[model samples]
Target: MANSPQPPLDALYQEALATFDTLLSQARGEGDPEPTAMTLASVEGARVSARIVLLKGVDARGFRFFTNYRSSKGEQLAAHPQAALCFHWKTLRNGVQVRVEGRVATLEAAESDEYFATRPRASQIGAWASAQSQTLADRAEFEARIDEFERRFECVPVPRPPHWGGFVLAPDRIEFWYGADFRLHERQCYERDADGAWSRRMLYP
Candidate 1:
């Protein structure tokens, strides 16, 4: 008798991608707004912070999102250069959870600019006006800043702000979890090694 052949790591990754696409599509069709929202966690030394961010892109490379470079999360990533992300869909009956852990890097300027161009004009101006994660004197002051930027870009295309751009999290570990009865859930994890090879394993639940 011969032993069973194991599936390649890349195959498992593709399967995970397919599953994500299917779930996302279903969520959208079921009228679940903000399906792309995810929780991003960052750390610097002993302190850690987590926030909700919208996912901008996903592919074999990793997950992508944009933020103000001067924000707290941005500062944390700069100091640590690694992070984790969690995506949960509770609207579904069984529910699904995805976890990703990886190193982070800033996206190229051109790529960021292209994505920025797709944002609504008001949002583009808001991106320019905001001093994210910083103390604001009052709502009036922030609105004034928005007004200023609005006047400055009148009848012109708003360019991506220098401090606003995207970050790509190149995942080293990715896990998918499915809710089960009696809390006996299922989990599948894929990890990349130093040699750039991937390995897949099942996690006890």
Candidate 2:
């Protein structure tokens, strides 16, 4: 097979970012929303568990997601304090994979309160009802709890769960990948040195 042309790391990064921005627009217009859902992977004693989660925010600081502070992923991230996030958009044949390693901290009470306020009433009630990652006797029992919470909080705004909050992943490494014709692919990686500066590099496909 012949080697296909590949975009330079910088160019590819810009292209992927542009495509991602367009995708974001489509989601907003359609009111479908970007899955922003990423596969979060955590390592524990050479074992790893991964699950999808909705991303709350992302920027130079890092990506943010909220969940129960005591959930399985939350506990693993707390103990290991490092994880990976992958965003793949099959509809566009594009994906962004980020590797983040940093300490995790629960969001401040004020921040959690503000975010919770923006959630739908049902979501707010569900948060209060669900134990998140804990076992329940049966589906009916869980539904009953949800109904109870709905009744209890009726006409009153649901408060943020004491155990619910968000975490920011300060990425030490960020990798962006793009698909191309044939099997040729483009990869660009950014590494943050001890001095807290980002350096970019290209990788073989």
Global CA lDDT of candidate 2, please?
0.73
TM-score (all chains, Cα) for each model:
0.92, 0.80
lDDT of each: 0.89, 0.73
In model 2, which residue pairs have backbone atoms overlapping below 3 Å?
none
Question: Candidate 2, residue 159: CA error in Å?
Answer: 0.6
Q: For residues 1-205, what per-residue lDDT tens digits would candidate 1 score against the true structure?
A: 9989964547766776777788778777777678899999999799889999999988877899999999999889988999999988877657778898999999999999999999999999999999999999999999999999999999999999999999999988888888888989999898888977778899998
Quote the RMSD, in angstroms, for model 2. Answer: 9.6
The Cα error of candidate 2 at residue 168, in Å, is 0.6
